[model samples]
Target: MNGAQSLIKTLANCGVDMCFANPGTSEMHFVAALDSVPEMRAVLCLFEGVVTGAADGYGRVAGKPAATLLHLGPGLANGLANLHNARRANTPIVNIVGDHATYHLQYDALLTSDIVGFARPVSAWICESKSAQTVAGDAARAVQAARSAPGGVATLILPADTAWNEAERPAQMLRDIGPAPVSSQAVDDIARLLGNGKKTTFLLRGSALHGAGLEAAGRVQAKTGARLLCDTFAPHSEVGAGRVPVERIPYFAEQIVDFLKGIEQIVLVGAKPPVSFFAYPGKPSWCAPQDCQFSHLAHPHEDAAGALAALADALNAPAQSSIRVPLQLGGLPKGPLNAMSAGQIIAELTPDDAIFAEEAATSGMPLLVTLSTARPHTHLPLTGGSIGQGLPLAVGAALAAPERKVICPHGDGGAAYTMQALWSMAREELDITVVIYANRSYAILNIELQRVGATGAGAKALSMLDLHNPEMNWVKIAEGLGVEASRATTCEEFASQYAAAMQQKGPRLIEVMI
Candidate 1:
């Protein structure tokens, strides 16, 4: 068998069934091999950013790595932004980047560039296959690396010659490894801290913000009178009725400091100490209070859920100590569609078991706060602080869990970064409802300009932040991309359009003029 076939077989055997690809000439052989291996489902993405971001979404939902096929260094560069997001999210992904033939590297062809150098910053593990006989083993190891503790991105650079050459046999599939156990001493220490009666909080992320970890944390909170807070940008979190509610740290440093004001101790669970997204002129970078003592209960690589459960036992938490949020849908607003009205409409209409991918920037914060107590759903945010992740992430999440409806609330400025994802959604017939907040400007940047101490009244600077020379017709754009869409100018219009979209199947878009 050819090396490409061997690699595909190895990936399928190791539980990687889906591949997001935007291929070029160097990857033709690997593309052709997809037909030979019927088990590997190949998903075509128009842009490399969509390819990488979709893989990130799939990993968050599937709890396994999805492969991404890019052309070469340039193509890998095209996908690097979302790869940065994936790295920060600690999502499992196997990047298969194609390179020129081994012998052709000496000539430095037009597409030839430093592939390894570009991959090092975003990848936790990287390997270049030297020969066809070694490609299968390399691919197997790449999967192993991606599925390591807390998951990570593993890049495998494949030369053309190695892909086309014959291999002796397919490599054996590697076994999946579990996360490391949390230390008993660490759990006991956290228990003692909680027993001291000082004001304390549990800062959560990764697995500790959802599922069993969240339940254990709720028990700890009920028993110890401590608060529960999640990171500002969590990769994935399950929320809504019957689940424990977690307050997210505010994005602004000033607001975060206020939120954490009284806390005397912080027990981190798969999260870092609160810090500002950027250094402001007069604000402190660290958001925690000056007297707050930090303690690590569980690292990201350790078993966070297990650690939380053990801590609950140590605290002597009661069996029914978990706090459950009751269903509380807000009433629909009756005026023009501003942030508040829009948030109310969404909270009233969002379906149960939906997957919400948010990139609404400043406009969506109010909506997120409203939906915190809405129906049960899974929330996926932009973990890497990158824009243009919402739509593509919705695509991947829908693909991963076909039974669950995916809802993406995107900002107008950020939506332009990866709009090609709409076409993919239409082609795949995915159940996704995209709500674009058509403010016609980079609202977040405008807020940042003020935060960074930039003075007002400059024509050029204001022009750069505005998107209104000609307003973007999102309805026309969505129709052009083969997806049904509508424009909503008022609260009633938005509620009607959103309800209609949810009732229908396949992909749809609603442009809310706020």
Candidate 2:
């Protein structure tokens, strides 16, 4: 067998059956190996960013790792932004980065660069296979590393010679590893804190924001009068009617500080202590008050849901919380095409079990609030501050769970960063509905400039954030990419387009001119 074939086969044995790829000359052998390993389905993406982001989305929803085949150092660099998002989200992804042959390195090839340096920031585990004999085993190890504990990016740098050379068989599937066991002592301590009668809040992330963990948190909150709040941007969480609701920390530092002002204590469940996204003049980076006592019930690498459930059981908490959010479908507003009306339309019409991969930026906060009372669905947000992850994330979510609908509600400026994802959706025939809230500017940056005290900025400075000189015709863009598209200039038009797109299957785009 060739090294590339064995590597693909090993990945398949490890349950990473899907590969999102944007390859080059160095990766030809690995690309060809796809035909040999039928168990691995290879999906081509036009941009490396899409390849990485799609894998991120797939991992968040499928609860496993997806492989990404990137060209060389530059290709890895192209995908690094989304890799940053995946790292923050703790999403599992096995990256196979192709490199020039071993002997070719000394030649100082034009494409040559420090691949390891580019990978270090994002990868939890990284290796460069020296020989064909070891490539398959290395690939297996990459998969294992990607899925271990809290899950993360694992990179295997494969040289072209190693990929083309003869090799032994594929590696056997490694032993499966789950999240580390939650500490019993820690659980008991948190239970006592909950019963201490002090005002406390639970800061949550990871699995604790969804499914069983979420339910346990609700039960704990009902039994004890504490509150449940997730970070401003969570990796994955089940929200809306019938589920235990979780309030998200506000994006602005002042808002989060004000939000956490009165809480006397905080217990973490698979989450970090609240911190501001950025430092502001005369503003604190730490969101929580310094006097508040803090404790960890579960670390990100531990079994958060299990720990919370045990805490609830220890407190003899009720099976269900009385604070479950009730269904509140809104009557669509007919006047203006704006964030509030558009948000209500999308929220009220969102189907159960749907997946919303969102990077709506300045236009998303109201939508997030409205979505809390909509149908039960999984929500994936930009965990890393990166803006371009939304469109490609929906691609992976749809592929991982094709039976469920995947919606990408994106910002016009950020959406431009990875617009090629639309082509992948059309090519893969993924069931996704993309809503483009085209306000024709990087509106968030405008707010940021003012917040940062950049007063009296020139027209040239403001022009950098504007997108209006040449307005993006999203309808034509989507059509050119092989997806059906439509435009909505009014609230009524938006309601009709969004509703219709939701009812259909395959890839569809709706541009909301706000």
lDDT of 2 by residue, 155-246 (tens): 99999999999998999878757798987888888877777778899999998988888999998989887889998898999998999878
- The lDDT of model 2 is 0.92
TM-score of each: 0.98, 0.99
lDDT scores of the candidates, listed in order: 0.91, 0.92
Give the per-residue lDDT digits (tens) of candidate 1, residues 429-487: 99999999999999888889989998864989899999998988999999999899999
- The runs of at least 3 residues in candidate 1 whose Cα sits more than 4 Å from the true structure, single-residue gaps closed, are none
How much is 271 displaced in model 1, in angstroms?
0.5
Which residue pairs come into collision in candidate 2? none
Give the clash count for each candidate: 0, 0
> Scored by Cα lDDT, where does model 1 land?
0.91
